[model samples]
Target: MDKANQSQQVTELTLAGLTDDPRLKGPLFVLFLLVYFITLAGNLGMVALIRSSSQLQSPMYFFLGNLSLLDACYASVVAPRTLMNLLMEKKTISLVGCAAQLFFFIGFGSTECFLLAAMAYDRYVAICNPLLYQSIMSHRVCVLLVAGSYVLGLLHSLVHTEFAFSLPFCPPAEIDDFYCEIMPVLAVSCSNTQVNRHLILGLGGLVEMVTILAVLVSYSFILSAVSKISSFKGRHKAFSTCTSHLTGVTIFHGSILALNFRPRPTDTLSTDKTFAVFYSLVVPMLNPLIYSFRNREVKSALREFVVWK
Candidate 1:
């Protein structure tokens, strides 16, 4: 049979979920269900708080609000499907469903990376050129940055998704991940995927390098500006303001690094699952706490909003 026919024949795929033990299904489902709720509530609430609070109308919060939105979306792309599959005996997903999941999962994740870099740039401007912060990060500029991030994300995801699904999947149709990740799907293809893997590494690495370089450069400038501040308290305060963004970036990029740089994440299924859970579930729920809840302004805003309500 021709390759197109072989590809067409793959109508659905089975997921080898988090565990095979039937006894553990109930516990796992409950655990992930609770996590999903917290992720949605935390991230969505952050967006609402940022939008409603007059105090949070700064460029920093503008970037943060979008980050919250992206985290919620990124988690949703994996969490709900994971929860559903946990309940089902077969854990089967349609080809289209798998494709959609992978597309959005990669898209949102890539967007978040760019968004974090944008946030770092915002911090740089605020620290390095305080007087020009407002003018430089004008509303128009912020919107354009966000739009560009999404465009880049979509392009990256589209290329990888199309390439992954284009190859004919050899049957059993079982993916080793709970969600349809690109690499796992590619691993199952009948076609020789060495070139595709290399291309993926090249493009993914390029994106990673660009974003990380932006973050590093921005922070280096910020540190330089902070060092010039003579007062100990003043310098401390400046860095304190950035602590949240730094924390969020560290956690997010740390997970990405572990997955990519450790001899490929898929080589060790247990390690892959650990980072997968970290990316798909833990990060979203933690982002609000890391970025906003711990901030003085957001706390005050929340208190005021509560009192008013």
Candidate 2:
């Protein structure tokens, strides 16, 4: 198509949300609203507890606090619009709005990946080299790690968003998923998307693989270190330190792998949407609960704060 004709294509795209059955909308809205509320309360509460409790001041909780903040952010990027879409007669987002959504979603998602790897490294140092843990994961080092995650996330988002949005969207620009995800957006494009697909597969796969490898290697070393503790009690104590993080990692990475790493047959859009819901919404709600409920230190800090108040 010529430039003039391409420019005349639909600028506002319609979203085919989670369901088309009108009867499902009310129930789905209530369900998602409840989930969103819990996500907000849980993440915000965790951040507040970490900030206020001096006893919880450590490299681990520092990262946990940031994880909570990111969870809230990542959830906010999609959940509100999803909630509105469930209620609205027409689920539409302009091209610019869609681009912004894709940017922030990818940015925060990538940041979380790096942050999880950083947290894994922190755990490795604490468990494997206790004596040098303090020096190695110093405040400055932690800050730099966190900052680097955000910077990399921003760059990743910028590249993907620019590439995805630069393509000409054809008429009948209806996205198959609930949100403006890279794959769904690309599927609706008039321009050839082989490059975009390769970029998504290559870059996205690279990030996921590297981060996951880091976590796996760190945990392998951690297991080895824990096994060296001859006493059952000592081994248990060591394992307890990583349980919460391991759980969070499992849920987050499991959902992401299901979404991105799997083969994308056209028939699997519904399955993809289901995984997206888990990754984008349910995972955020679960993170705070996983960390706070599973960790003795976090529980103790909460109890102490309550008693003091």
Candidate 3:
């Protein structure tokens, strides 16, 4: 069939998963299966802990719970299919299914970017304006922020997903990546993909720039506020509150920005796949640990819960 006919008839695309090495499949599956479960346990446990604990009755913990929820969903969007494909000889997903996956994946990702900014702003309020922090970062206001993040994330994902599948993909029509992110799907298109490419990059860059700026500006103010503290203990306490959030921000944004703004696609498949896995799988699993180990309140809460049990 011709390209046009094939595009009309094609309902699915084969996924070229992480590796084709038969020797590595079993090991990879076991590794990622462990990763996925740990992610779920950690993230979900954080959410529950935050919700159930009275000690965590603050804007920061509220945002942390939401962040944990997003991480769980974010990891879930990619991990199951990746595990399944690891065992399958011919890994395939329907075009509609691919769109759905990309929609949720990007939805969680974009929401996370804005949510991180909100989190930074929350810290700024807590540190820089402690007197008004409770009033400024009220429950109603935090709920509004989270709801706004979801709305914006879903809308952005909608536009990207709509534009993506609109293209009449070329023959073979197989996606080279594990998931249906914009760039990978675009690589298989029969039509001029320059516009879509630019659109995705432009939109993604715009969102990242805005969020990164918010985080940076918030931190700058926080630094200024911290500098006024006379006591070493006061300065240390102020800095301690920010360490976990800053660590998370650095890891999440550093990986994403590096991968997104890479000079060009590398010759090897592993680079792209590695980035995809790191952000999706590893980050989620690591976040709970980052918060648990770094934050005193979380550790205390965990201990209390353990003692109560």
Candidate 4:
């Protein structure tokens, strides 16, 4: 078979994207701009709030501040480009631009995965070993965990980005979705992708699964400990501390697992796109809101800021 036939047999990918209708461009651009602003403001506000608040100087809040920073960095990598593409006629990303996007996106994303796991462990110590919470979640330990998350993210991103770019882009370098992603890029590769697919499934899948398992195990112990607490107020406080993290975890993992693990041939591209939005856009925006709006401390701090204003 010829190259064209081979390409068709592999996949009929619309790398530039599905919609080029001028009529839809204006509305889409406005909508994406709104999303970008919200994502940026929400994540940055959370970071600032954590830094400025004396009551939030604890280890848990420290981790949360780091998480907020990660979310902001994660969203910045892809959302601006997506917003611009929605506004412009041509939605082309240069090779170097795409590589940078992939690097930061993967770095922040991987960091977040580990950071969430670290947060879960923090909760585990707080609940399961309340007497030792301070010692276990000491300032030094918290700093190490936060630094580890970023370092791991950087290393993992380096591996994936280097491997991804190793493949030559002979022609037709188009990413189907709004941003640079592994699956879409793999599909566009003219060379054999069996090794790449296997590595992605093994390494990427393992990292996600391990982090999720760690969270689940930590939460299980936390729930057991929570059940033993006799005071209603105590129980409520304990549960509230974790509710935001749990909600964010559910959204992030559920959306990503559903998108990636489903039967590829059976699922539509539209389905993937919707799920991508949840991870790449909505989750970052929601992280701050879910964690901060629901917390009394955060609300009180915001109120004080408003009063001062």
TM-scores of the candidates in the order shown: 0.96, 0.96, 0.97, 0.92
lDDT of each: 0.88, 0.92, 0.90, 0.82
The most accurate candidate by TM-score is 3
* Per-residue lDDT of candidate 4, residues 177-292 (tens digit): 88888888877777787887888788778879999999999999999999999999999988888988899889887877877776787778877887887788888888998987
Q: Candidate 2: misplaced stretches above 4 Å?
A: 2-7, 265-267
The lDDT, on a scale of 0 to 1, for candidate 1 is 0.88
By lDDT, the best candidate is 2
Candidate 3 regions exceeding 4 Å error are 265-267
TM-score of 3: 0.97
Q: Which ten residues in a row have the lowest lDDT in candidate 2?
A: 1-10
Clashes of each: 0, 0, 0, 0
lDDT of 2: 0.92
Candidate 1 local lDDT, 81-169, one digit each (tens)? 89888888888899899999989998998998899999999999998988999999999999999999999988999999988887888
Q: Residue 309 of candidate 1: its Cα lDDT?
A: 95
* Candidate 4 or 2, higher TM-score: 2
